[model samples]
Target: MNHAHSWVHAFQDRLDLAPFGSAGLALFALALKFGYDDVASIGIDAVVDGPDDRSVDLVYVDRDQRLAVVAQSYVANTPKGQAKASKAATLRQALSYLIEVDLESLPERLWPAASDLRSALAEGAIDQLYVWFVHNCPSSRNVSNEIRTVGATVTSMIRAHFENSNIDIFADDISSEVLEQLYTDTNTPILVNDKISFITHTTLSFEEKEWQCVIAPIKLSDLKSLYTSHETRLFSANVRDFLGMKAGDSNINHQMQKTISENPQNFFIYNNGITLLTHGVDVFDVPNGKRIDAHGLSIVNGAQTTGTVGTSEIEPPADAFVLARFISTKSGDLIGDVVRYNNRQNAVTASDFRSTDSIQKQLVDQMKRIPNAEYDGGRRGGVSAAIKRRPNLLPSYSVGQALAAVHGDPTVAYNEKSAIWSKDALYSRYFNEQLTARHVVFCYGLLKAVENEKNELRKREHNHEKLTKADIAKLEFYRKRGAVLLLCAAIGECLETIADRVIANRFSLTFGEKDSPEDAAAYWQPTVKAISGLHAHLEKAFSDGLKNQEKVRETLKNFSQIVATLRAPFAEFFKSVENKLS
Candidate 1:
């Protein structure tokens, strides 16, 4: 369908509106999303004549309290619509149904109970006016001019019809910057040009007598309701309640977690290009089952908060090894509790968790016996058995080292590494797995979150000094998906960053399993392709944000390029390593 068709689709869904009224509503909705507000339509004979045959799509009510009808010209075909499946048709079709109203009587008609409502609501001044047009199968060359002319015609009618309103009219979707550029670039005398550009130009006469027109006057609120309802029904229901659910709906998050947990094997795995150095971790969950990890870590969706826990609150599962040893535990889900604990740790301690050495010696000894404990390679690399005996000593040692480093205590500074590596290996393992998955989901969610963030940032910059909790909540939302894409993209970028000479050196580092260059490069191929697929998926999802989106979009545009840029080099790198191994 054309733009006119899709726009009308939004309006036609409302069973209560008259056909002309529905068209008017659609135009108003388009005007709202596109930044036009307070619209009024003008024309008595046209209203009586019926909007079924009118060429205009929407009408605008100026801040000055004048009414102007508008007509829009939008193209339909593969590239703009079918090629990418955009909303151009719906927007165009909706724009074609312009409504006409009387400026002198518009205040009374629009707000029947009060004529001052328009001015009172607008707070006395208006900024822009709009006119929409409807045309059928007009040639490409004539569409632009036709739109301008139709808008002009409605402007003239509105001016002659009202006589003294200071209202100015403009075409739909023309931003102030774009309009300024258009006017400045046009060939006309400075004085006349300034006065007769997009803001000032009005049609003295209509040239396209062949096209049909429909015009109606409708309330902006009704339009907003209709369009949003239409969009919710057609595209995304979540967008319908964006403001209400931005911090996120607990129900939605639960549902998402349920879906993921219910289908773990089927869920696509996304790694952060990092993994446990050793394997074999086992854990049991009643009513569910047992899980095994070759890399000593299993990734599961992290627990979601029920929101009952405060930032200061901390709780531990009775059977758990670490938190269980501390204070009395609380009942309820552990996810929110864990998040709170982490948050508090970061806030008060500036670290997420206590060092393993902080645990009592008896408890530390018991924890060490538990098989498949998560390990930190950086800290546990080569600790002596004697040092391992002192469980609570590590935290003090680590903290002391940090202080001593600043205070010039050589012994404290020398042993800082042990403090960092004192946590349970199994715990770190689970965290890595969960975080890898969360990060990927977060990246994907970021594309959708961009506009919301933009609005939030604007509000913060103008109205609030600090960002709201809701805005920060978006951080968790992004972490849930964004990390996956970031990891995959990181791998791709890494491969590209290494020059030809360093490529051989990189392949050695890339392979954890083999020293053979050939085998290493061959193993890298599938990994590269997997990362590339991730890039492709994200690029498509974020196509609207051209700059950030374009990075991956261009990278994945060609299948051959993906293979050449990412696949072949890895293959050669592996082959070279394999020869060395042989």
Candidate 2:
């Protein structure tokens, strides 16, 4: 149609691409003819929270910039209909497409090229490797915590993968002398955790590990709108003008032309500036006069200082005309569709398709139609055979070996690419530590309870343990003094001990029977050691901890059960306050 052709012409200039003047132009002519109107002005068909809905078929994954788009439609659409409609692409899918698709030749197909559009990708300045991860949360306290855990997991995976290679494979593969120099330059790693989020870094020295963590309550809606709107508003001017109005009033109408001219992407929300606006919507109300809606005409910004007082309304036409114009002038709809399709394809593709079929069965089906010669080539290990083996080289195939593969030649200068920790190891380390810390704190409390009951048994005057009533009474007095001293030690260890007399007084008050100073000095070492050991174990695990989750959980569960079992007798023993007054 002539209408669709206009769009094709408009975008060719906008994208700095040639008008469909190519050898393959005829092959795609039918697609362009049918989809020209709808693809020219794309929009999300539905908003999905997850993957289960039948409507969702495509997703858009924006790069490091914090923007993403996805869409879904009912299953009835045809194969050609599917091609014309754009879908959302997941990060993994986007990466693959980016590598496979040639941007130069297919400008109309991949319009809104990553660079042509304005996005947080440029704003955030995320030049380093970009990571997107999916995960499961054991307890659903905070859904966003899932995002934080994924990030940490990816970081650890990278570090471990690199560390092993630096020590093993890369060292032998590259010049040894260069490897040592590179190792010396890196710092001991640090990991910090706030309740909600954490970051980790490392240095060469092992002395101290540091972590930076943050915890905040964030609304998911705020994040989605913040980034999504910015990305959408990047390419349209008519939408921009509609958004600049401070209040829907007469004055805005007078200056409407100026607003649209100033901010073109109003058609889509970009720059966090014009977030909510759409074409073919009402712009001004005449009440008794004439009511003007969005579709009738487009608004442009004003340059002149002097302006008309009344809504200097310019009449365009009807809603359909405006809709037609929007589709004519902008490619937002098409780009959004592409993003949606990408996501749908990604979700379906990434799913475990091999679940029902064996690899041999799949190979047989794939080879059935191929000529015997082609099958023979594959059997003999030709190009197709090499492709099959590539997955084996990926780190996920065997996480343990992946640990050794990430380090680039330690002998050479650091290569920024694959030489970082693998994703699996990093996730394993942090998840294990948090679980272990909770277990240790619980056990430490139980140990002290057990100690208290044993001390109680030592001085009880009952003949079951020692002497008669009178002798027992005397022993009781000493037991009371000793109990007080122990309590002081617990407090000093549990809390802090200042330079005041309280620390020494707590111990002195409990000395029921006079004893040599040497006796008190002898007890100090063991008590300090116990407290020190508890702190060290917890801290070290918090640093590197256990990388394998199953092993760590099993260990923690055993420790917690042991401590809980000891609680009964220990509670009874401490149930007696010293009978000093009696």
Candidate 3:
């Protein structure tokens, strides 16, 4: 009855964040929430946790989703039947302080995050704010009530903070069970494991390799029941969630519900049918038509239709029916495509369109040759590949961002992954014929190093480990937006010296054939230290997020002169880099 998620322990060990149990859970939940493939992929600087953190453990903003999350997490010292309900007090305090109060009054550590969130909310950059109480214990009604209070309080505060802003805020109790379900959604397309049979008077069947589909009519009542049972889990593989009916007459969910009420019999013709992906299916002809049994069900499409029916206040008419297609497949490689192609509701991003580009294919092939590393180039294998964590796995977005930073533009790399893959000029700059997997290892490894150092500094800060005054100043500098990528770009400027060789071509540089990013990151550390030593240069170049390329180049030139004057005291590490080169 009392057990811990193995994945939580995995996150702890992978990031080596043991003993910081609550922080580990926070990272775990955020990774799932954001579809981050590994602990390394997460930006640890988002953690605003410390004694002075004002009950805000983490604050993560997703501009793409128009969402901001303020989370308070707890990890039990011992296994318990349920998590403490009182943990919600932490979120309550956050709502009262961070949301309701002016940003100027916040503690220095929290002020930056609070300010970012405030700007997002007030400027209408964000429309959804989530307050999550995440813990590694079973959920209880007691805690659920507390979570509700937290949600209500945050909702009230949002209005007070942004009087005319249209932001919908929610509070969620992300207990261990809920966390597991979110994890399951990433690993598989379907989470509902119930085996159920369907009967229809008219039906058609089609077959293909490792897949088959049964087309039939499904009663609206039955469809609603399935949705009511699983909710968003039914659309686990869907590209987007049910974008509930908004304040407009043209909203699809609104139309679907109205059709069901005003024209029950015409529902099938007027509305698009649903597609259900399943683990297995068995079909047999009955006296009237066909009977089919399916297991492990999820709706790949028609989430809006199903959600509208499920959430409808009035019961769906018994006579109404919706056309349904049940597709059965066990192939992971193909299901990702199935999910991607079937989701017509969501806007396909530029990354999706670029996944098929000829350059991406070559990069994908080159990356696969390296051991203990995987790069999708563009497509990250969707739901199938996210089942497990690979700390060294370089997903498409990270690679794009890293390449963009080291090549030239830290601003694009830090903010425009879509633009990198979508824009022809930008795509060619990073993914041209001159680029190789080895070069990616070089740039990506340096970026990983930057991220790791930022995390290490914050870990020590949160753990209350002793830090010298200078070290604390360094941590503060690393906290700035685009700072890690900015530093990565800084280090890339001196790759030739750091490699301790006259490298003619920077794009061809690599840490060697077998070196993983984690190991290769060590070579970049001395450079990071050297450049970061000149805090004034860093502030001048990065204070506004690498806006002026000439200013950044001047900063690097100054850094180079300082290194030459010091004779580059990092000969020992530079020698290591020289030795590792293939």
Candidate 4:
């Protein structure tokens, strides 16, 4: 099958298994296209029946983008007149619903997604509300314009409700053609150059390995063209993203630009050369200088330099120079090593190198063995394997969070951005020997179960439809701070209880030791059963906490208090397990 067809088939399989059918699949496809690491369907219903979906079919909050996407799917196998009308009506209703609903009064189940929207709005992180009208059938220009009009109306309403928050509304009709394009995997071939001339050349040796380096002076205009043509994809293989230079700042970029404009001759000496990785390079004699034709040229370092040079306001001198290091290697593993070495030289964060660690490799292999578990270790191979094998599984970052949770620090896992992968204290905690593949899977299961329950609750709320004012008020209470963190803390408390029991019994099946992986695999069934039992109790605790509703929001806001609240109940539940073991 072609790439598009294969992706469609995979999505179909997921839809068959998923509770929120077409709408959920559309959301997932969109999430993948936008490079979101994790997404859960917050749709209200499985099927897009008539009206009454309350206009929003699915919602996804992306923290990285500080964006919340609310989508309404209109899938019609046969685009008859009635079907088209229904689709159009649904789209209009979705837009109206978004405008009319008070975010603070949303049902409790939606609070997870809504809380993100609220946070972004309050922080001014998000300025646009994207409402996608996803349709299986084709749409015309007239329909698109109508949708845009509705979007403008919603934008005005949102501004009014949000205290002139200046939130824009973008409405687009994603037709079948667009969906196919989104799913299609396109691999663009990189241009190959055999020999490229450099004004100056040098050699660097690291650990007995020699690297060929050269300084190349190219027109600043040509560099801008390359950047515009390739965009961010040019830096995909690099460890760090391009940090743009500020006008008033006296950073390295500013100094380099200054030298380029003032004395072009000194540009080569003042600037650190861009480090590049190529599959191979060939040398050829030319008139003024030699030609270096490189294959698969990627910038491994000097992103800031490139960004600064490309975006500089003043015209660069014709003779401005950029240092280039050409490393010729076709091996993917070697490319990663070269990138890591260059990034380390530049003082990049430890998180960038976590994927290369021995323990991470072992964990990736173990996760692959788990049924339905997909682990992308941020490598090209791992990412390809995940796309081909298990497209529905959460991304590597989510798996990292699970690792953090099981390793006994859900607080950091819940909050800190990118710290969980650090090689110092945080990384040590995550890869602690006590953590087994099974523990990771168990945590994964708990998260999935909780997400599933949240979806089901949304469905129930939608079906009931007649929520009283008091009912809405009570739910609003549960929607306050620390609600999701409370869930994480409860899981942590349960695991702590399990650890205490195992230590007291001095059982052969211990966790977090050197042999924990083997022990976890050996005792997989019992461990899963114990986790399942604990999960049931934890779910009850959550439900009870929601029902009590009195000061629960305040209690949940404090991490320690949330854990303390759950500790006794989890300890009591573990007592039965200990007795059974006896």
Give the candidate number with the greatest TM-score: 3
- Order of models, best lDDT first: 3, 4, 1, 2
lDDT of 3 at 204: 85
Reference-based lDDT, residue 91, model 3: 82
Model 2 misplaced regions, further than 4 Å: 1-547, 569-582
Predicted candidate 3 versus true structure: per-residue lDDT over 383-450, tens digit per residue: 43543556667877778888887876776776566667767888888888888888888788877777
lDDT, residue 215, candidate 2: 16
* CA RMSD per model (angstroms): 31.7, 32.0, 3.9, 8.2
lDDT of each: 0.27, 0.23, 0.73, 0.50
> Considering every candidate listed, which one attains the maximal lDDT?
3
Ranking of models by TM-score: 3, 4, 1, 2
**Residue-wise C-alpha lDDT for candidate 2, range 512-553, written one tens digit per residue:** 122211222233324332332222222211121123334433
TM-score of each: 0.19, 0.16, 0.85, 0.61
Write down the worst ten-residue block by lDDT for model 4.
41-50
